[model samples]
Target: MKNTYKVNNPATGEFISEIEMNTKEEINLALKKGHNAFRKWSQVNAHERSDLLKKWMDNIQAHKAEIAELMTRENGKPIKESLGEVDYASSYIAWYAEEAKRTYGRTIPSHNESKRIVVTKQPVGLVAAITPWNFPAAMMTRKAAPALAAGCTFIVKPAEDTPLTTIRLIELAHEVGIPVDAIQYVIGEGKEIGEIFTNSEFVRKITFTGSTPVGKTLLKNSSDTIKHVTMELGGHAPLIIAEDADLDFAVSQTIASKFRNAGQTCVCANRILVHENVMDEFANKLTTEVTKLKVGNGLEEGVDIGPIINEKGYTKIIAQVNDAISKGAEVLVGNEYNANHQINTYFVYPTVLKNVQLDMKITQEETFGPVAPLISFKELEEAIEIANSTPYGLAAYFFTNNYKTGIFLHERLNFGIVGWNDGAPSAAHVPFGGMKESGLGREGGTEGIEPYLETKYLSIGDL
Candidate 1:
């Protein structure tokens, strides 16, 4: 089977390219190159590696506008939004450039007068980085940046839908003196390509960002060989509103957070659990906010929201909307799909559903769209109950004025990352992974370097 796939622009239903798939034979060849490259790449000093990475950074910024256009064309995200992704990605390259210099060795306390103990971090080997379509630049950087900084080579297989930008990036890295085979690109069915990584002995570490069920499967695959794996998987994140919260701020934040990228974000708000005291007020404000949102081509100016990723996302969002409506949830703003100029473009209206209950699929499932289902809670305990009711534990947000309430939920949210009185995620300096089925390990902050490296201990005795 070939790893060939076609990329489409959902906003305008445009065809980008039909990528030639990598065969198993090609995968083996890449693996061989990755292994050979790893030995040579990892042997270089930290300063040399940092300088090489700096070249890649300069190249990325030099082609920022073009790269963002490629991203938008492939992923259906707004051009400006895609630019934001590239900007964030550049920061990661810059971060890793500095990190390469800071990867340190440690000295252990001596147990005997004539004995010395030492510990050091070394790159494991070739890293297999599998990234998803949502936030392609960020997810790619999260894995590739740190791994490269730790002196590891990479075999990056970006999601089939949005592989052009990634392929361009890998090519650019090669152009800047990073060995061609040091970073390989393969685009295709995620499962087919993933097996090539997990079953191969040459791939020393695996970093994946995608769905939960898929993450578990990857975890199981890597477990048989005990290959190092770091997963940044899916989430059905909840946004909680307390009675004492600022209704205006909470509504604005939720709309922005959830509707960003048309609500395809793994950390995007899916379920809205508002306190009973201000449910009506919040709903009214949310309706006005959502109704006023500009929905058009991603490349168009003043477009607040864009189309979903692809046909599968279109079908999923349609099904979820239909199910919610049939179950008595009222649509307050936009409903159904919007086609442009008689062509059934992938544009979905920013949907708002009220009278939602915990039993509905919209609340239980991750509605990867611009639909916000409203759930009311009579008390703080009830809000917490609804928030933790899902199977995911990726990211959750709560708006509350009471310090006690914020602290209480902060400790009991059953989530890996939480935001208080805010909608954006934690800084890139924090450990960014989730509990339960969300993912396997941390990606950023100080904890990120450990996964890319293996610790070695040295003990010296009297000679």
Candidate 2:
């Protein structure tokens, strides 16, 4: 018998609908079809591929309202944020469409007379993309757009909680002239589908955005075939407020960044480090700004923070907060949920904790919810030390008006992406990834298509 997965609304704790999971045989068939499609897709020129992507973008824009509602219902993000994500996702598709025609190659003069050398880029092959539930549509397009632009056939296994959005995405692809076999969507146990992706010889590359532990497992599995993998994994991003920073501006940006998407983002301010001289002022201003946010069902207008993804997420946040409290940290606003509340009622108040210790679990781990743990530092050196202490370094935010200090932090920070004055720094043209245990490879900018393309060198000599 085939397995099935059910969906739920975290805000109301209501069951949505059940969907059937693909079987092992179905996965294998999808792989075969994807491989077959690659043979044809790789033959299409870059301009034609660019044209197809433009149509896909138009489809997304035409259905933005429906897409945003579906995403809000499935992922529990505010409708406003959902619509914003749709715009973000479409921008990537449009970017890669233009980038496809600009895949440059070089011709070099051979050392030996009468010999010519040329290097060219081509699609790597079949690609498997595994995306998480947090930003289902955006992550899907982020990976899919590049792969398609590079002339590769691809398959997507979206998180079970948010498969509907991906299903709709594949529908748009087909409607916009993407070959049926060139893009496939399968929903099932991740282990079964992941094993096929990692072990299959036909699968040449895999891109996954999820936890570091799972990324390690996929890396280990892919080692057998030596397949190329791009892993955008876990992050414990830190935000630093220098003593010289504008207090009100820093506090407001912190609130916006920390609570966006209910802090489920990998790059959200997991640990906020404030200079000792301004710590008290920063904390007070941050608390006041956070309280202004309305937390409720995502469909309601002015609901800034939606419910936690599910019961597990709510429990995890509660446990992290309790652990910190036991270690002597104090709550500033948004206290823990009551113990009597049903597990199905999965909303955690948007929380901000003060007097946080670096050793506390909430500070060390990725608090994947709307909780900001503030830690104070006396000097710039101390602030940098505390920010770089964590093994994860995906992104960091620093607020400062001092030019020298801004350059110092920008250069010294170990993260892949850094925002000097801007709290929200994500862009389609900028490269994004992580350092240390955060993940591997980059996903955007001019180099975005590098993972999907393989280079070849050719030489000829004439008599």
Give the alpha carbon lDDT tens digit for every residue of 150-250 in model 1. 99998888887788889888888888998887778876578987888999889999999998888888889998789999988889999999899999999
After superposition, the stretches of candidate 1 with alpha carbons farther than 4 Å from their true spots are 1-4, 339-344
Which of the numbered candidates is closest to the native, going by highest lDDT? 2
What are the Cα lDDT values of the candidates?
A: 0.85, 0.90
Once fitted onto the true fold, the runs of candidate 2 whose alpha carbons sit more than 4 angstroms away are: 338-343
What is candidate 2's TM-score against the reference? 0.98
TM-score of 1: 0.96
Residue pairs with backbone atoms closer than 3 Å in model 1 (clashes): 3-21, 4-21
Q: Relative to the unseen true structure, what is the C-alpha lDDT of residue 112 in candidate 2, on a scale of 0 to 100?
A: 88
Residue 282 in model 1: shift from native, Å?
0.8
- Per-residue lDDT of model 2, residues 1-463, tens digit only: 7788788776776677799999888998999999989989999999999999999999999999999998898888999999999999999999999999988889998898889999999999999989999999989999999999999999999998888888988899899899999989999878788998999888999899999999999999999998889999999998999989999989888887899999999999999999988989988998988888998889999999888887778788988999999999989998756332463657778888999997799988898999999998888888888889888989999999999999999999999989888889998888999999889999988878899999999998893
